[model samples]
Structures are given as structure tokens and as C-alpha cells.
Target: MNVSEYLLKRLKEWGLHRVYGYPGDGIGGIDLALQKAVDRGDLEYVQVRHEEMAAFMASAHAKFTGQPGLCIATSGPGAIHLLNGLYDAKMDHVGVVAIMGQQASTCIGANYQQEVDLQSLCKDLANDYVVTVSNPYQIRHAIDRAVRIARDKHVPTVVIIPNDVQIKPFKEAPNAHGFTHTGIGETTFAHVTDVAGLHEAARILNEGERVAILAGAGALNATEALLTVAETLGAGIAKALLGKAAVPDHYPFVTGSMGLLGTKPSWDMMKECDTLLMVGSAFPYSEFLPDPGKAKGVQIDIEPANMSLRYPMDVCLQGDSASVLKALLPLLKPKSNRKWRKKIENNVASWWQLLESRAMQEATPLNPQRVFWELSPRLPDNAIITADSGSVANWYARDLKFRAGMKGSLSGGLASLGAGTPYAISAKMAYPERTVIACMGDGAMQMNGINEMITISKYWKNWSNPRLIVLVLNNEDLNQVTWEERAQSGAGKTEVTQSIPDFPFAKYAELLGLRGIFVNTPDRLGAAWDEALNADRPVILEAKTDPNVPPLPPHITLAQAKAFMTSLIDEPERASTMVNSARQVLASFLPRRRD
Candidate 1:
């Protein structure tokens, strides 16, 4: 077998069956071997339209499956295009191994075509491990170390193989001092909880009258434990954007998402809570957290570096979230006074009501908030949801309520655009029987989602359930950044830069032989969602939404309010913008009705 074939065999032994990538002559040998692996039913190669999308798919695959995702790319430009998505994986702390082809070793130093200093380019992207294979004997160690480091450290790793080296005869390292030998064996890290640390954390939580909990992606696996601890302490849980699915939003004391796009209930809970228990989340916003001296903090995280990084903690319990919480549970005392819990539930109830009121308000065509609101109740069980970075994320964070068994994620730390479609596609590929939905804005759709629709068309026929839905908010504007400029910089929306070309997203899907559903009115949103959910094939559900609707923050600062008024001085769309913003603000004060 050739070196490329041996690499595939090694990956199969490592339990990785899928590789997301595109083809090129630089990596022709690996492509041929991939076909052999496919024919033998040893692997499945997902060919994405762009190499970047391939990397995004790999990242998403890891997030959903908890396995080391694999992506292969040809040299130079192909390697460069994978950076954005690889960085996404790196920042989010997912296991991904990127195999990049390089020019032949003989021609690499001679500056042959597609010959770039890949090691230098990938130094930061895969900081934990990056190696270029020069000899066929090194393939074993290269693949072994890359996958091991990626999976164990939760970081992206890179393995570069020269084009000529890929076709070389496979060789195992000799049992000699000069050559290094490696074996395929997975290392499992034990979760060891410190007894003193757990006792201190429990004491702080037990002593507090009003306790608040912040959950992030790290707490996803510890949902039941998190819920139990919150119940014991009478704490309200606030999820970071990355931890939206860490706890079911249907819980009474669960305050939706926290940050600029957070709900008011979360903001209020953070402000009032006297003690804080942060679990496996490094939520960046300090303003959204309680005042420094007001709350005694306790944090649980596996990484020592992440402990006390966001907020100063009195007790830092370093271990797996579930393990630490389980150990600490026995030492904690359950609170009898339920008044604090009652207030939190009330806040959450009123917040949901306000969101519905805002979503139901009239707009020129349709409100973007209403689109997500309409789908919240219609979401299928165990559905996987993805959102692209833009104004769409605002609605995604607040409007949708995730239940148990549902998996949802986006580009968290990277927060890059063009990830929604690829993430959803990856989710469906990994769990073909589960439903998947991708929410995106016009800007993100134009950026990469459109090209990936062809990808969906290519693979949808093979899915067991065939229920992927790509929902686009056709607002004709880069609404998020435009609003950011207005709210943060006190500048009016720059029409030339913010205004995007209008496209018939639904019609485009129809042309691709996929189902298309269009909604331009609030009344039709629920029906359109129903049709999309029950469609025969994959679907593109497009909503002709208004760009003027404001994505208000939980707590609007005095400066932000002044900045909005200042931007209105010369804002071209001031009339409609002001009207919509006023309506959203007024919705918060609307009377709450008992459901």
C-alpha cells in the first residue's frame, strides 16, 4: 500500500470514518487513495464547494459528534482557505485534524508552483502541533500525534504531506535508535475532583440567599447535574451564547442567553445575585456579570487556565463539570426559601411575553424576530440548529427555546460569517436521522450559504430523514454591522457599504430541485414553517424581512441610547428605524397575560 493508503488505514483504526475536503492535483495521490477507501467502505469523503466550507464542516462535525473531525486540502491556496474555519475550530476548542498537501520535497525549496511556507502559515492556527512529513516512515507518527493532540487538547492540529511523499511506498520505522515509532492508542483523561475545592464551592453556594449560575459549552455534557445543582441552590441559570443548549430553556429558572444579545431576565439575575457559580464557561463580558465585590464566585472547569479568567473566584474546582458537580452535590445544602427562584421564573416568563409582542408587531413586510418566534414551537425533537454571525444571531439567541436532546452551535469565539450552512450540513451528515436547521441573514447567505446550497442538493438524497432547512432573512442589508455602527459608534448606517443586493433565495432553492417556501407576511410565517418542516426534501425557507427592526440589548446603556439618537441625525432610514426601535422598546412594557 502507498503512504496515502496507509494514512487512510491509520485514520480508520483511529475510528474516524469521514473526511471533508475538495480535490486538487497537488493532493491527487490522496484523492485516489480516498476513492479506494470509499470503494472498500472504509471511509466517506465529503467534497465541499470551497475548502473553507470543508474545514467548517469538519469543525461542526467534531462539535456535534465529540470526535476528532478530519479535513484534507491541497497545497498553498487550498491550505490558506482552510485557515478561517480552522481558526473557528481552534477558538471554540474542538478536536480537528487538518491534512494539507504540499509541493514535492525535492521541489519545495526550489519554489515550485503552490510551494508556500505552510509551517509558518499554520503556526498559530494549529499551535498545539504542526508537522510536515518528509519520509514515508514518518506518516505513522505524524498521523498519530496530530490526532492524539487534537482530541486530547481540544485544539486543531495540522499534518502536511508532500505530493511526492504521498505516493511513496509505505514503510514502518525500524526498531532502531535513529527512527521514532508510534502506535494507535487513545488516551483517556481522568476527571479528578479536588476534595477541598468541591467543599469550598459547595459552602459558597449553600450560604448564598440569591445565587446565579452561568453555563457555557463546557457544561453541555453536565446538563442533568447542572439542573440538579441549580435546583439545590435555588439559582437561576444564564447560558452563554455557546452554551445555549447546555440547559433546556423550558426550565423555570433558566434565563435564556447572556451578553449583548441576552434576555433582560439574565441581566437582572446577574445584577441581583449575591453568589455566582460559573460552570465550564468563559463568558467574556464583564459588564454582564455581577459587580466584583457583590458576589462570591465559584467556578468549575477542566482547564486550570480558564479558572478565574473571567471573574475572580473564591473557589476554583478543576475537573470535568459533571464529575465536579456530582461530587459537590453531596456536600451542599438545599435552600428552603424559594422566593428568589420565583422572581427569576417571573422574569423569564415576562421576557418571553415581550419577545412575542415584539415579534407580533407589524412591519413593512415581515419582522425578522417573528420568523424565529414562529419556528420555536414548530421545531422538531432532537433538531440541530446553526446560526450565522449577523443580526440573525440576535433572534437566534433570544427567540428560539432549546429543549433536551437538541444540539445547537455556531462559530462562537471566531463568530465568523458563512458557517451556518456548513455547520447544518455537517450536523446532518453526522446524524442523518436528525432534523437540522440553519438560520442566516442576506449578507451571510450571499457570502457562502448560496454556494453550499449546491452541496446540500448533492447530498440530501442520501440522508435518512432528508429534513435539512436553510432559513434566510432577506433584509437587503448587512443589518448587524449597520446597527453596530449606529449604536456603538454614533454613526449613521453607511448605505453604500451596508446595502446588499436583493436575491430570490427561495426561488434559487427551487431551481436546484429543492423545496422552497417564501413568507413576506407575519400571518404566513407559521404556515410557511409548517410546509418547510413537512417538505418531501431539503428546503430553503426565505422571509422577506424588514432591515429596520432593532436588535435591542438586554440593558441599553446611557451612551448607547445617546449614540442611537446621534446616528439618527443623518441616518437615511431614520424614520422607519426609529419607529421599529420604539415599538421594540414599548413591547417590554406591555402587560403580561397569564398563558
Candidate 2:
């Protein structure tokens, strides 16, 4: 057996049957091994446009499957391209493995062409574990340990394989017996609940009124328990962006999302709440939280380092979310006061009304919000939605509310662009039977997704009529950055740097031999969505949307308003944009100060 073959065999045994990467000459041996494995049906190698997309796809696959995702890249530029996607996995706390090629060991310090000090480059970004496999005997131990660390710790690990070492002949492969594999049946398991911690958390809940529940991705496993906690405490549940799936949007007393891309009821709850009970989410934005002294907090997390990292905690309950909540439910006393819940409920209802008005309004060009509004109802019950980062994310986070069975994901903490299409493709590949939709913007789609269309075209015949849609919001502007500049810098006019030339994306999809639909008016949006949903193969729907629409923060500050007004003097054509901001601010029920 050769070293490359042995490494591939070990990865297959670890349950990584699919690998995403763009091949290069440096990893010739490993590439040859992957081709043989694909022929045997032991693995599938996805050829993506850029190496970055490959890493992003691997990250998304792991997040969706709850298993470690694997992506391969050759030496130098290919390896460097993997950093952003790997960082996405590390920041979001998902398991992904990156197998990178290295220059031959013969030229250690010679600084060969495309040679980079990978160990030093990746140590800080891929912090969980980063090592190079230098010897034949070290192959099994290094690859096995990398997979194990990624799965157990839920962090990405990079394995650098030297070119000359990969082609080296070996008489025998290392045994897997001595290694600790974390497979379901082979791994030891236990349910841990902190008895004392739960008691203290309940005590804190009982003593406080106007309680608010903050949930994040950690709460995904304990939805029923989380709801029970919210109901017992008479608290409104607010989800962090990554935790949007923790509870159904229609659930009573559940404020949609928190922070800039948040619901009005959530903003109100944070400002007025007396006690905050956070679960599974280490939400980073502390400014959106209630003042420290105004509210006492109880946080539940499996990782001790995550507890109290974002907000002050009165009781830190360090344990699994589901187990701790199940044990804590019995100790809690239900609140008799419905006043707090009622007030928040009314705010949530009012917020929805405002959203409906903005989304359905008639305009010369289509309102971007309407696209999501019409698409939401058309979504399959088991659909997987992937959103890109930018102005579109605002509508995606606010407009698209999935039911219990639906799944959604994005580059959360990394907040990286160009991952939307890859994430959607990975979801479709992982769950071939379910529908997958990518809500991408023009800038993000053009960045790394334009040529990625070739991937869908080349591989479409393998699926059982997979339902995959790439809905491009073609506003011809980097709308999110433009909005940020306006909101933060008091710049009322859209800067020339943020503008992009419009492209016929629907026609671009046609050139790829996929179904394409173009909609310039709001009236045509419904039909385009329907056609895309029912298509036999992959479909792309491109809409000419309005770029002037701003994704305003939940609560507009006096300073932001002042800066906005000051900057508007530079351009007289921004009156409509100013009015839209005012409407969004008013919808949140901003209180007026008394003189």
C-alpha cells in the first residue's frame, strides 16, 4: 500500500465518503488515490470553482449532518485559500477536516516555488489542531487524531501531507486498534446535568419578573425543554442569528431574532427585561443586551469557556442543554403574571403587520423583501435554506421563518460572503431528497458562485431530480456595505465604490444548460418561485431588485439619526432612503424623550 492510499482508506473508515476540493499538481499522488476511491464508490470528489468554496462546502456539510466534513487542497495557494472556510467552521463550532498537500520534504528550507510555511500560517486560524504528516508510520495516527479532535471538540484541523511522502511505497499500513475512534457504538456516552446548578438557575428565575429567554444554536437539541422553560418563567424567547431554528417563528411569545437583524419585540424585551436566561448561544453583541445591573442572568452551556463570555451571569449552568433543561424544568415555578408576556406578544404581532406592508407594497422595481415573502410560503416543509451575508441577510433573517422540520444555515460568526451557494450545494448533496435553496446577493454570487454553476451542470444527472434553487438578489450594488456606510458614517448617499454593474444572471444560468427565470416586476415573482420549486433539475431565479431599500437596525439611535441627516446634505436624492429608515425605526416603537 502507498501512503496516499492508506490515508484515503483511513478517512473512509472514519465515515467521510465525500470530499470537496479543486485539484492541483502538487497533490498528484493523493488525487490519484481519490480517483480510485471514487471508482469504487467509497468516496465522491467535488470539483468546486475556488478552493475557498470547497472548504465552505465541507463546513456546511458538517453543520447539516452532525458529522465531520472533509475537504482537500493542494500546496501553497490552494492551501491558503482554505483558511476562510476553515475559520468559518472554527468560529461556528462545527467539525471539518482539511487535507492539504505540501512541497517535497527534500526542499525543507529551500523555499521552493509555491512553498509556504503552512504550520505557522494555520496555527492561529486553525487552532484546534494543525500538523504535517512527515513519516510513513505517522500517517494513521495523525489523520485519525485530526478527525477525532475535530469531531470531539467541534473545531477544524488541518493535515499537511508532503508530496514526496505521499508516493512513498510501504509494505503495511498502521493499525486502527490503538487509536480512539468516536463512532456512535464504539464511543462511551453519558448524559450530564448539574443538579446544584439547575437548582440555583431555577431560584434566580423564580425571583425575577419580566424574564427574557435568549436561545442560540445550542438550544437546537432541546426545543421542547427550552419552550417549557420560557412558558414556565413567562419569558419571551429571542434567538441569535445562528439559533434562528431553535424555535418556530409563529410560536407565541417568541421574538424572532436579536441584534441588528432582529425583531422589534426582541429589542423591547431586552430594554425592559429584569432577568435574562440564555441557552446554547454565545451571542457576541453585548450592546444589544440589557444593561448589566438592570438584569440578572442564568446561562446554560456545555463549554465552560462559553459561559458568561457575552453577558454577566448570576448562575452559570455548565452542562448539555437538553439534559440540564430536563432536570431544571421540575424545579421551576410558573409565573402567574401574564402582563409582561401580553405586552411582548402585542409588539410581535405589530411587527409582523409592518413587515407584511413593506413586503407587499407596489413599486417600479421589485422590493427585495417581497421576494422572500412570496418564497417563504412556497418553501417545502422539509426545505433547507442557505443565506448569504449582506443586505439580503437582513430580509432572510427576518422574512424567512421555517417550521419545526425545516433547516437553515449561514456563515455565522465568521460572517463571510461567498459561502451561500456552496452551503446550498452541500445541503442538496447531503440530503438529496430534500429541497435546497440559496438566497444569494449579486456581489456574493459573482464573487465565487458564478463559475460554480459548472459544478451543478456537470453533476446534475446523478441526482433523483434534486430540487435546488439559487435565488439571486441582483440589485447591482453591494447593498449591505452601502447600508452600513449610511448607518454608521452618516453617509446618506450610496458611494460609487459600493455600486456594481447589472448582469443577466438568468441568461448566465441558461448558458450552463439549467432552467433560468428572470423577474423585473413584483407581479412575476410568484410564478418564478413556483417554477423553480417544481423544476426537475437545478434552477436559478434572478430578480432585478431595488437597491435603495436599507436594512435598518431594530432601534435607531439619536447619533445615527444625526449622522444620517448631516450626511444627506451632500446629496438631495436620498429623501426616499431617509423615509424608509424612519418607517423601520417607527415600526420598532421607539420611545420619545421628554423635555
Candidate 3:
């Protein structure tokens, strides 16, 4: 047995059936070995165009499958390019194993071409980093440890393998069993000593004042428990975008998401609530938080570091959400405050009404909000939506409603651009029967979208389902950056540098042997969307949009507004044009009733 064969066997033991990556010289020997394994029907390699895309795809696969996804990259630049995607996986808490190829072992100190200290570079981002020793006997143990760290900690781990080691003959080690698979432990209850704190929280709830529950990604594993708590406490629930899978939108307590792109009702509920209970959520946006001086806040989290990190809590309970809720329920007295519940419920109803009204009145050049509204109803019940980091993210995070059993995933904290395409592809691969759509902006699509199309063509050609559909809003500029610049300097200039040069998106999709459609009006959008959803293969719907429109951030300072205005003050004509364009867009969406 050779070192490569031993490594492959260990990966098989780790339950990795597919590996995502591109071939490079540093890993050329291992690649050949993998090919040999493929020929022997021992493994399958899913090739990707770029290492970054490979990492993104692997992250999404790991997140959905609840297993460590593997990504391979060659030495030097290949390993370096994997950082952004790995960081995203780390922040998102998706278990991943990045197998990076290294230069020959003898070239370590010579500064050889494509030689990089990959182990050091990935140290902070990964939970574990191991450089394979030249001795083939150590290969199995190193691979085993890397897999264990990724699976147990729910974080990325790196294992750097030298090119020369691939050909070395494997020597049998005494303890070849490697690591054991461990399942998540059963939930355990924790003792709550804060009797006074529990009473105080119950009193606020029983008083009939508005109350809202905010959930985050941490609550995903405890969705049932969180939902039970919401019902028992009679508190309306609003999830952060990262926590979309925590509860379905159809749930009675579900108001919407809370953030910049969050729903108005969710934001309004946060404001109106005299008492707020944050359950496993560390929503980074302070604007959505209750002012500490005015309203009382209660937080239940497993991580102590997350507590008081965003909003200072009046009552902080450190325990798993399920454990904490079970403990707290028994200590608290049930409240029959119909008025308080009704007040918050009415606010949610009003908010939904406003959303519907807005959607009905929206017209011309097709409002992105209206498009989302139309698309949401048409989506399959088990659809999985993946959003890229850009203006579209803000809209989807707030507006898109998930049907029962439907799931959504996005790059939230590490919010890097160009995740949508790869994420969608991976989601489809993970759940082939479910509808998977990549909602992205033109700016973001240009970043990493094109590569995944090729990946699908190469690997999943015979899969007769249109598992991935990309909805590209082609506004022709980096709208988010342009908005930030305008907001800061009042300059109405569309930063040409951010613009993707001459992107023939539809033509490109067609060239890849995928269906491509260009939509201009609402009618065209509806028809094209319907076609894409039902297509037998992947499709891309490129919609030309108003570039001047901007997705507002959750919180912006008055000082920031002043700076933006200052930029506009110098160029009155350009600023006036921008303002008029915005007004027209708004006017087109304003509510109107036929006489």
C-alpha cells in the first residue's frame, strides 16, 4: 500500500464519498492516486474550476449534510485562495476538511516555487492543522485527527500533504483503527438559580405588554424547543437570516427576520416589545435590539462570550436553549395576557398587510421586492434557497418566506461575495429532490457563479433534474458599494471600477449548455421564472434592473448620512438625478386603488 492509498482509505472511513477541488502540480501525485482510486471504484472526485468555489461548495455540502465536507487544493496560491471560503465555513460553523498539497518535503527551506507555509496560514481559520510527516506510517493518524477535529468541533480543519509523500510505500501501524465516530450527546437540563430573574421576566410577560422572541443560528438544532418556548411564552418569533431554518415562516409566532433586510413587522415588534427574549441568537445589528435603558432584555445562550456581545442583557442565562427553556418553564407562572399577545399579533398582521399592499402596487422595470413576492408563492414547498452576499441578500433575508419543510442557507457573518451559485449547486447535490435556487445580484454572480455551471456540466450531467436555478439581477454596477459611497460622500457616481466588464451572462449560460432567459418586464419575469423552476437542467434568468436602487443597511448613523449628503452637495445635478430616479422607483411602488 502506498501513502496515497492509505490517505484515501482514511477518507473513506471518514465517510467522504465525494471530494471537491481543482488539480494542481503540488497535488499532482495525489491527484493521480485519486484517479487510480476512481478507476478502482473506491472514490469519486468532483472537479471545480477554482479552489475558492470548491471550498464554498464543500462548506454548503457540510452544512446541509451535517458531516465534514472535503476540499482539496494544490500548494502556494491554490492553498491561499481557499482561505476566504474556509473562513466562511469556520464562521458559519460548518465542518470541513481542506486537504492542501504542499511542495516536495526537501524544498521546505529553499523557498521553492509554489512553496508556502500552508499549515501556518490556515492555523487561525481551522480548528486543527496538521503537516504530514514524510513517513507513510503517520498518514492515517494525521488524516484521522483532521477528520475528528472538523466533525467534533463543527469547524474547518486543514491537513497539508507533501507531493513526495504520495509515492512512499505505506507501512502498517499497530493502531490502525484511527478515531471513533461520536454522536452529539443527549440534551441535559441545567439548574437555574435565578429565581428572582425568572420572576422578573415572567412579570414583564404577564403584564400584557408587547413581547418578541429573536432566534439565531445557534437555535437551529433546537428549533422544536425554541418553537415550544415561543408558544408557551406567547411571544412572537423573528429569526436572523442565518437562522431561517430555525422555524418555518408559516408558524403562527413567525413574524419574519430582523435586520437591515428584515421585515418591517419584525423590526416594529422589536421596537414595541417592552420585554425581549433572545434565544440562541446573537443578532449583530444593534438597531433591532431594545434600548437597554428603556426595555428589559433576557438572553439564553450556550456560549457565554456571545452574551452581552451585541446588547447588554437584563437577564443572561448560560445554557443550551432547550435545557434553559425546560428549566425556566417550570419556574415561571403561565400568563393569560391576551391583550399583550394580541397587540404584538396585530402589529404583525399590520406589517404583513403593508407588505402585501406594497407588492400589489409595485410596477415597471420590475421591483425586486415584487419579484421576490411572486417567486416565493411559486417556490416548491421543499425548496432550498441560497443567497449571495450583496443587495439581493438584504431583500431575501427580510422578504422571502419559507414554506413548511423548506430550508434556506447563506454566508452571513463571513458574508463574502459569490457564494450563491456554488451554494445552490451543493444544496441541489445534497437534496436532489428539493428545488434549489441561487438568488444573486449581477455583481455577486460575476464573482463565483460561472464556475459552478461547469462543475454541474462535468459531474452531474446525467442527473435529469433542474436542481439549480440562478436568478441574476443585472443592475450593471456594484449597487451596494455605490450606495455606501453615495451615502458617505453624496457622490451619485456609479464606481465604474466595481462594474464587471462586458459580462454576457445569458450567452455564457447558453454556452455552458444550460437554459438562459433574459427578463425585462413583470410578465416576462413570471413566465421565465416558471420555466426555470420546471426545467430539467440548470437555468439562469438574467433580469435587467435599475442600478440606481440601493438596499439600505439595518443601521446607519446620522453622521454617515451627513457624509453621504456632502458627497451629493458638490454635484447637485447628479444628486438631483439620483433623487428623481429613486422617487420614480418609489412612486411606481406606492399603493393605488382603481377609481
lDDT of 1 at 537: 96
lDDT of each: 0.93, 0.85, 0.75
* Tens digits of per-residue lDDT for model 2, 1-595: 8999988988889888999998887688999999999999999899998899999999999888888999999999999999999999989988899999999989978989988999999998778789987877777778887898888778999999999999987434434664332332234337566677778888989998899999888888889998898899888999998888888888869889999998778999998999999998889899899988889999998778898898889899877788888888899999998899999898887777777766765444888989999998888988899999998889988998778878888999999988899999899888888888999999998898787778888887777756789999998888888777776787755657777888888998899889889998888889899999998888889989877766777888998778767777764347667666555556445432223
Q: Pick the candidate with the highest lDDT.
A: 1
By summed lDDT, the worst window of 10 consecutive residues in model 1 runs over: 586-595
**Error of model 3, residue 418, in angstroms:** 0.7
Winner by TM-score between candidate 2 and candidate 1: 1
lDDT of 1: 0.93
Task: List ranges where model 2 is wrong by over 4 Å.
Answer: 170-191, 572-576, 579-595
Ranking by TM-score: 1, 2, 3
Q: What is candidate 1's lDDT per residue for 107-189, written digit by digit as tens?
A: 98897899999999999989899999999999999999999999888899999999999999999898998799787886876
Q: Pick by TM-score: which candidate is best?
A: 1
Clashing pairs in 3: 260-554, 487-564, 488-563, 488-564, 489-567, 490-564, 490-567, 490-568, 491-567
Q: Residues 86-120, candidate 3, lDDT per residue (tens digit)?
A: 99898887788989989999898799999988777
